[model samples]
Target: MIRFQHISLMRGTKTLLENADATLNPGEKIGLIGANGAGKSSLFGMLRGELHADQGEIDFPSRWRLAYVAQETPALDRAAIEYAIDGDVHLRHLQQQLAEAESAPATAANGSLIAELHGALADADAYTVRSRAEQLLTGLGFTLDQMQLPVASFSGGWRMRLNLAQALMCPSDLLLLDEPTNHLDLDAIIWLEDWLKRYAGTLIIISHDRDFLDGVVNVILQIDEQKLKRYSGNYSAFERQRAAQLTLAQSMLEKQTRQRAHLQSFIDRFKAKATKARQAQSRIKALAKMEELAPLRAAAEFSFEFRDPVSAPNPLMVLDDVDAGYRIEDSKGTIGKKIVSGINFSLQSGQRIGLLGVNGAGKSTFIKTIAGDLPPLSGKLHTGKGLVIGYFAQHQVEMLWHDESPLWHLVKIAPDTREQELRNFLGSFNFPGNMVTSPIAPFSGGEKARLALALIVWQRPNLLLLDEPTNHLDLETREALTMALAQFEGTLVLVSHDRHLLRATTDQFMIVADGKLQPFDGDLDDYRDWLFKTKLVAKSLNAEPSPPAVSERRNAPADTPVADNSNRREQKRFEAQDRQRISALKKPVETRIKRLEEQLAKRNARKDELDAQLAAPEIYDAANKETLKTLLTEQAYCAKEIEQLEHEWLEQQEALEKIS
Candidate 1:
């Protein structure tokens, strides 16, 4: 176990944590979460010994090996695989010793040293280090060919993947990852989730991706109110527990407030009377002894909505037999390379779409073409009248002038708008007071992303194209964006790895793969299954063929059967029929599952309403006893119904899986 005994940490003049104490058990997967600038990374720094506590102490097993992703990767000519292999410092040292021993002059001492080194290498499993490194790279979305390239050849994002691979490659008792999925696509994020689930060590992660944390971590360590608060279970569980705590705290505060008011009123009314003077004084003493309950101060929430577009055409845009890709011009002539071809898509008003694909699978190319950032290589693209597009990507965040204030950026776009109005608008996005006027150079990535989004909302475009908009946002901001997108009265095309955002905001999905774009037949869960099956098929196709058995070879006929082709065709037909049959059987089960899920959601919502009512002090008053009783009865009923519905949902899902 790792223990923090009254730990207080400071970053210069600002206190990040004060009198914080927590214990982390071995092999616990902890999700370290907090708002932006809430000291998540600082806590990690303290654990890594790059920062120290200003008071008290932190104690853990000194011998435990710790591994964390490096913030920067030096440009080097070393092969990517070799760089990952270097993460295992002990194995590399052993290999070096073995090489040096073998190269020395032959002697008894040298021979003994060589033998010992060989044994050490074998124990370290140094020979298989390359293969393990390759697996790590592959899981992180690196292709086989790219693994052999020099580290300096890759771009900045790929370099970050390499750094993550290196950290994963190391053998450690404790692992710390900060936003590991930030640079990953959906496919890579899923892979990392599975990998982290199987990791048999103490793991701590800081991530804004809620689904990723829910799928990987078993415990949540939140940095709130300058303290380290630990909660059992995953992100969802933490949310439930935190909500309960907040409800209870608010209830207690309200009750205390009423008690204090009542006592004060009594003392005020009777303190001057002779008969009630003693009683009033006694009441005043009681009031003075009463502990003051501070009001619960919730974090400032970010909330904004997309202003209605000036005009919305029926069909915002249309791509007729379009080839989406880049056009490269050389000295010879212009050349077009198709990334995704034959895309016949229509962007209708109020359509919400989520784009799904692995890394380098043309998702960006497709989005860029729609955003008019790139001209189609071929085919006609028809735009509806009064079409206005608000496109957001990482580049938009980067395009913000670092020297300018948030107010200044808004003013540039809405030049004629009053300064006070612009400032008020910025406040809705959580940029208030000095933050609105301060230079954004010192802003965090989350701040930059929020600013970029604020600029987009100001445009009020009829069609919005957002690519990974939640990349640098915290959970609160992401939720705000989700709500905004859900309520936006316009067409939306989003490419993101945040599953929660995708599920909540998009009503349909399209997949980009194999140089083709098409509608995905199912939801995110189905997409996960599709990815798994696709990988399996690819692996089997790439696997080496085994030799024929000797007996089978001997039994082979010299002459071919004349009906062989017909028989094979008949077999394929039967297989197709079987697939159709299974699909037919699955349809009703899927429908039931969907219906059950809807019921569960409704019941859960009602239960939440009941819970909120129960938390209010007035609900428990004598006059409202009947109402309180009714609420409790409904809450109980909702709970039972939810349980039954969930069970049915699970059964239907299992049936569908079995059919598949």
Candidate 2:
């Protein structure tokens, strides 16, 4: 267990945390949530003893091992996973000692050395060290073949994953994760959630991804106005409860203010009366003693209003067998390898479409092509007459000058747009007063995203093309954007991984698979469901039946008319038998699938328990410690079962397809 008692964190002249108290139990998943630069990362540093607290100590058991991921990049050379895992000098020394002790002859004089070696081995969890390393690497999205590849060859996101993999591989009493899901895709995020669930340690994760938080965390530690507040439950539950508390605070303030006003009125009317003078004086004293109630300021609520799309009778954009890519600039405009080719698609007026594909699958390139940033190779492109499009590219936020404020940017969009009104609008996005005046350069990634979005919406273009619009938005802001898009009567072609946002804003999906764009008549969830049913579930339903007996007696009827009553009756009976068999087989497959899903859920719960236990040094003792080798064997068997279930599910789906 870990607890912060009367902690205060200050950065220069700014107070980031003041008298903040928070308790995190083993197996308790807590989310450290706040706006950008709210000192979430600093809190982790303080807890880990890297940063000194101004006024309090972090209480935890002695000899506790804690791991943390900082928001800033750390210097690391490109190395293989194996090398990285074993690179820690202290751990390597322990491993060497263990190896030496293993080779030494047994003798009474060597007893103490052997005992010391065993303790070191236990501390290192050396019995299943390799398996732990492998699991951590795999969970972080590394394939077996990729484990030995140089980390330098990976992208920034992958490098971050490698860092995360190292943290998980270490046996720590507590895990401090800050925005771990930022660079991960949906699949990788899900895998990490499962891994954390099974981790036998305490974890405090600071994240802006609400979905990820809800899935893994059970508690919320909110930092607001340099104060800390604790709530029991996931992010959603905490939010609901927080809102209720705010409402109550407002009501209490209103009631107290009303009482004060009534007392003032009485004093003003009765103070002149001779008999009521004493009573009035007492009322005055009461008024003096009465505490003034100031309501807690409500959290920001953003409302995005887009300009009405220009009404056009024709489609806004079209691409015909075109190839799109980033071209090297020379005297000539186009010169580069086409990243995506043979793309054929069209965007019509009033079409709300979502672009779905893996990252770097040419979605951005295609959008750039439509925006006229890149010319298509060997194909024609067209835009409807007067098609005013607002495009938000990946680097759209970079266009804002560091010194310019939101109001300044608003003025650029429209010369006469009121500064006060623009400030109010920015305030709705949680940027208020001096924060609005602060240079864009100091803003957090989420704040930058909101500012960029605000600028784009101010343009009021007829066609809105957003790429990963919800990239850095919180749950509330993302929802507000979704609502705005839903109410938007214009063409919206967006790229997003947020399931809720995609479902709420998109009407159709354009799947960019294999360098080709194909329009599907559904949302992201629906597409996922269809893919699962067809590819995973269907395979389970169609197992082969026993081979049919070949006989001359059966062949004799090949040319014969089976329209006779007896022959027809026999054929009907055979058909009914086949139907019954198929139905019976399907029932068990369905049941097995359901059971496997339930088992997965149970495993997740158990994993969470393990995480809590591991996070507590008391729960993790060298004396009563379970053998790492035994745990590894059990974990491996469970992992194998999960893999087999997935494989069998796929095969079952294939069998079902054959039967159909």
Candidate 3:
């Protein structure tokens, strides 16, 4: 258990936490969330013992081991697996001591030391350390070949994964992870979430990704108004609880304002008259000393609306046999590599399509092609006369001038705009007053992302092509953006790992996978199930086999008002075939179950007869002692056999249930 008692924390002149207290119990997975500058990292530092509370005590068991991902991983020549294994410093130390003891000169003392070291090694399970490290690496999306490669060989993101693997490899009572899913794709994020769910130790993760938090964390510690308040439940639950609190606070504030205004009116009407002067004076004094209620922090400052498009054209763009990819520089000449070929898509006005695929399955490429960021590698793409594209990618934030302010950026978009208009627009994005003039160099990733989004909305683009736009945004900003996109009267094509965003904004889904593109006639839940069955639609539509009967019904022909007769016929055929397959699989299992039941019944009957004989009073007599022992042994054997058969029957039943 960890306790923070009357904790007052400060960094320089800013107070991150003031007189806050929280109690974190063992084995609880907690999410530490706040705005960009709200000091989540500072709290983590205090927990790690690298920083101390200025005014209160943080008490925890000193013997408890702590583990956390290193912000940076050194470029080492050691194998990635070995680097991960190094996280278990205690196990490594024990192994080193054991090696030393074994290498020492042969003597009674040395032998004794070696024996003790071996026992310690066994206790630590030092022999399985390598396997455990490998498992962590694999769970973190490292391939077998990648695990054997040197730690220096991987890219920055992969190196971050290595750091995570190392942290997870370490044995600890408390584990701290900061934005562990930032560099992960949906697949890897799911894998890490499942692994963390099974972890027995306490986990404290700081992440802006709401879905990830909802999936893993059981508790939420929100940093609000310089106080760390613990909320029981996931992120969604926290939002509901917080919203209720804000509503109550707003009501209180309104009531206080009304009371103050009514009192002031009475004081003004009577203060100058002699008869009411004393009462008015007393009212004035009371008003002066009254504790005023602070105005509510308006539910969201990040809310901003995207400008409506000038002309909303149906079938905004059409890709006629287009191949989406990049042009590469070769020694001979420039060459084009088509990432997704044989693609056909049309974006109509008010159509919001969520793109689904694996991390490297040409999602970004397709989006880039649509945005005209990259030209089609092979075929032609026809655009409507009034088409306007608004592209927001993760890299767009990096393109912002570090020295220039948001005001300057917006001014470039609207050179003739008035200063007040510009200020109002920036204020919608929470960039008011000095923040509008402040250089973006000091801005956090979330701030930069918000600025980028503000710029996009300023352009009034009709078609939005956003690729991972919610990468660094906090929950409030994300919700604001989601709301903005939902209300935008524009066509949307988005590729993101955030399921909540996908579910909220997209009306339809288009899959970009296996060098091809096609419509996904399903909802977000179906997409998740498909992702589980098929590893991100690894094959082209025609190449892969047809879906199951249930899928066929859900995917009934879109061209027909009702299911066409032929479609119904096909669905019925598939259903029949499914039943046949299920029945074939069930027969043998049912036969085995019947046999187990028969054996159990016979054993139980024999045991009952033996029990009856053993219950006879003469069975306890010395003359019948042998009979009693035999009866007892037989009964024990019968009971054990029945239990074993029942276990087998259960296994068979579970298997059949899964099939059904």
lDDT of 1 by residue, 1-660 (tens): 889889898888888899999999999999999877779998899899988889988888999999999999999999999998888989988878877866777665665565566556655656456767877887788888999999999988899998898899889999999999888899999889988998998999999899999999989999998999999999999999999999998999999999999999999999999999999999999999998987899757777899999999989999999999988899989999999999898888899999988888889899899888899999999999999899997467788999999999999989999999999899988898999999999998889999999999999899999999998888999999999999999999999999999999999988887788877767888787666545533432343112112221122233434468887666566566666755755666666777787888888988898889889998756666446546755665566667667765775676567657
Alpha carbon lDDT at 65, candidate 2: 79
What's the number of clashes in each of the models? Answer: 0, 21, 0
Q: Largest lDDT belongs to which candidate?
A: 1
Backbone clashes in model 1, listed as residue pairs: none
Comparing 1 with 3 on TM-score, the higher-scoring candidate is: 1
Candidate 3 residue lDDT tens string, 38-59: 8999999998889998999888
Clashes in predicted model 1: 0
In model 3, which residue pairs have backbone atoms overlapping below 3 Å? Answer: none
lDDT of each: 0.84, 0.71, 0.81
TM-score of each: 0.82, 0.70, 0.77
Assess candidate 2 and give its lDDT: 0.71
Error of 3 at 325 (Å): 2.9
